[model samples]
Target: MSVELWAQPAMMSDPAPEQMMEHILKRVGDIPPLPVVATKILSMVNDPDLEVDDLVSVIQKDQGLTAKILRVSNSAFFGLCRTITTVKEAVVTLGLNNIRNQVIALCARSMLETRAEGYALEAGGLWEHSLGTAFCAERLSSTLGLKGTADQVFVGGLLHDIGKSILSYYVATRFQPILRLVDGEGLTFVEAETQELGFDHAEIGARVALRWNLPEALVDMIAHHHGPSRESKNRTQVCIVHVADAIASMLGLGLGVGGLENRIDDEAIAHLGVDDQVVQDVMVHMSSIGDLRAHIGIN
Candidate 1:
C-alpha cells in the first residue's frame, strides 16, 4: 500500500495468499480480450443443449476457423485416414469438444504470440510453452483416468499463464528490479516478485483469468498452481496443470524470465501420483510430445 512496501527487501518467505491476491486484483485492469470466434465457440459448446447444427452454423460464420479445424482434424495429430472437408464433418469425426479446444488453441496463438519483454519471454515463446503444457496435461489426464474431457484440460493448460500478459507492461517498467532479483540475486521467482512488486505473477494471472470469466476450476488452477497444497476441489486437475507447467518450463520449450527453479513441482507430482517411472515414461514419449506440439502450431 505504501511506496516502502514496493521497495521492501527480498525475504526468504512468501506473503499471505489472500493479501497478495487482493493487491493484484486492485492493481491490474482491462486484460486483452479473447478472439470473437473463440468467445462465441466457448459460449456455444458450454451450452448443454446446443446441437451440432448450432456449432456448424457458428463455425460457418468464421471461414478461417472452419478451414483451420478441418486442417487440424486431418493432420497427423488426429491420425484420420479420410479428409475432413467441412466444419460439420470435422465436428462429427473429431467430436464437438476436441473441435472446441482447437478453436481456443488457434485464438490463443494470436493473443499470446507477442513477446512480453517484461517477463523476458520472446515473441511466441509463451505460446509455445503454453501449448506444450496443454499437450502434457492431456496425456497426464488420460493416464490418471480423470473424469473430465482431456480437451478441456488442454485448454486450461494453454491459458494457464494468461496473467503473464496482464503484467508485461508493469514488469517492463515498474518491476524490472524483480527480474534482476530473480536472476542475479539467487531468489526464487515468487520471492523476487514479493520483494520487488509486493505480489507475484501467479496471483496476477489468476485475477486476469477471473476477469475473463473462465471456469472457476481454471481460475483456481491459475491462482494456486504454485501453492497446490492450498487447492481443495479438483485438486487432481490443478496438480496436473501445475506439474505440466513445471515440465514445460524445464524442457526449454518457452523458457521465460522464470529460470530453472521453475522445475517440476514435487508436491504436484505426489498429489497426481506421478512418480519416477511416470516421469521416465513422459520423457520416453518426448518425441511424441514434440510431434503433437508442432501439430498444434504453437511453434
Candidate 2:
C-alpha cells in the first residue's frame, strides 16, 4: 500500500484537524510546558561536564521539587536506612540522576493531569499509562542490560506517547474514522492515524519533545516508541518503550483505543540479542502490572 509518511512537517497556520493536531503536537505551545526549575535540572543532568554542585543548585532552586525528592527518598519506595533532609544529602544518597528523575516525574504530574478532549482519555488514565510504561521500561532495561540510566529509560517510557496528549485535543473529534479503520480494517494506531488524520502521534510527539529542549536521545525514544525500527540512537530504549507500551495497553492501564494490533518489534529484539527467556521473564513479572495500576498516583 502506498502511504504518505507520517513524517512531521513544519508548524503552519490553522489547517484541518489532522494538520492542527500535527501543528499543536509538533509545537510545544499545545502541551503543558515543563516547569522552569525542572527544565534546568534536566539540562544539567543531560550535560556530561556538569558539576555535581550545579545539579544540587538547580534542585535547591525549586523548593517544592527539593522537598518532594527528599520525601520520596525517605519514603518506603527507596528503603533508605536514614532520613534525608537536604538537597546535597538527597543527591549523595539517591544519586544525582535518580533525584533529578524523581523530580521530573513529580513535576510532570501537574502538567499531565488536565482533561484532553480530542482523545477522550481522562487526566488520570494518561498519567497511569505513562507511569506503567516507566515502570516496565525500568524492569525491561535491567533484564536487557541496556546502556543507559534507569531514570532516563523511565523518562523515555513516560514521555513516549506524549504526542497522544496533543492528539486527544486536536483529533479526538475527528478520530472516530481512524479508530474505525483500526477496528474494521485491523490497522495499527499509526496506520489508522495516517489513513484518517494524515499523521501519527509518534511524529507529532517527537517534534514536541524536540521543541521542549529535551535530550536528543529522549526525543528519539518518544518519536519511535511506537516504531522502534525508525532511526534512534538508543534502539534498545526504543524497543523497551515499544514493549512497555504494548504491555500497558494490553493490560488496559489507560485508554487510547486499546486492542490495536500490538506490534512486537521483532527486528529490535533480534538486534538487541534478547532471547525468549528474557521475554518470558518480563511477561511473568508484568503479568500483574494492571492490578498494581491503582497503587500509583492515578485517580
Candidate 3:
C-alpha cells in the first residue's frame, strides 16, 4: 500500500489485483482521446440519418485524414477505374461503409503504432496484427452473413487488443512472474495477466473503448474477444472478433511475448457457424493486408 502503485506499476510484486484495476483505469485516462473527426465518422455508423455529405463534411475538417482517405480510395485494392480527386468523390465512389473503415484504420494506426513495452510488441508489430485481424473480422462477417457493415465488424477486430498498449509497461515489470503462471501453472496469457495484474488486457481494453466513447457493441466486442462469458449479451459480435483474433495469432501476425499460449474458443466457432476450413479460407484471403498499410500505416 505504501508503494506508488500508479507511478511504478512495473515495479510492483504481485500487488492487489482489485486495487490495481482502479489505478489502471485511472492511468488509461491519460491516453489521448480519439481525433474528433475519427469520432464523428464512427457516429455515422450509429446514425443512419447521417448522410454522405455529413461524412464528407467531418472528414474534410481534418485535411490529413482527408488526404489519406482519398489515397486509399484510389488504391488498386479497390480497383477504381478513375482517380478519387476529393473526399466527397471518394465517399461516393467507395461507399460510406468503406470510407468509414478507412477513417477508423487511420485512427487505429495512430493509436496502435506505439511499441507496447511489456508485451514486447515492437514498432508496427501491434499495428500489423490489428490490421490483419480487422481484415479477417470484416471478411468473416460477410462470409457468415452477419448482417453488419464491414466497418462494424472491422472495428472490433482492430481495437480488440488496445488494452495491451497501456498494459505493456506493467506487464514488462511482471513479465517473469506472469510467465511463470503460464509456464509453471499452464495458464493462458490473459489468465496470467488477471491473476498477476488484477485485470487482463481484454478487461482494460473495454475500459479504454468506453473512455473513447466507442459504441456499446464495439466495446463489448473488445471486452469478450478473449473468452465470451456465458451471460454475454453480445455473444455473436464478440465471437466474430474473438475468432478473428485467434486467426491472427494462427497466422503469427504479432504474438510477441504473448506467444501462442492462448487457444481459440470453440464456442466462438459454433456461434459463428464456422469450422477450421472456413477459418482457413479467411486466412488465405487476407492477402490485402499490405494494401491497408500503404494507405494508413505508412507515413
User: Which candidate tops TM-score?
Assistant: 3
> In candidate 2, what are the lDDT values of residues 73-101, reduced to their tens digit?
77765666778888888778777666666
Q: Candidate 1, after superposition: displacement of residue 24 in Å?
A: 9.1
Ten residues in a row with the worst lDDT in model 2? 1-10
How many residue pairs clash (N, CA or C atoms closer than 3 angstroms) in each of the candidate models, in the order given?
Answer: 1, 3, 2
Model 3 agreement with the true structure over 116-186: per-residue lDDT tens digits = 76788887788888887888888888888775645666888888888887677778878999889989998
Q: Whose TM-score is higher: candidate 1's or candidate 2's?
A: 2
Q: Model 2's lDDT to the true fold?
A: 0.68
RMSD of each: 6.6, 6.2, 4.0
Q: What is the lDDT of residue 196 in candidate 2?
A: 72
Candidate 1 residue runs with Cα over 4 Å from true position: 1-32, 40-54, 61-64, 71-83, 147-149, 174-176, 183-185, 291-293, 297-299
Model 3 regions more than 4 Å off: 1-15, 46-50, 74-83, 288-292, 295-299
Q: Which stretches of candidate 2 lie over 4 Å from their true place?
A: 1-27, 44-52, 76-82, 116-120, 147-149, 286-299
What pairs collide in candidate 3? 17-198, 118-168
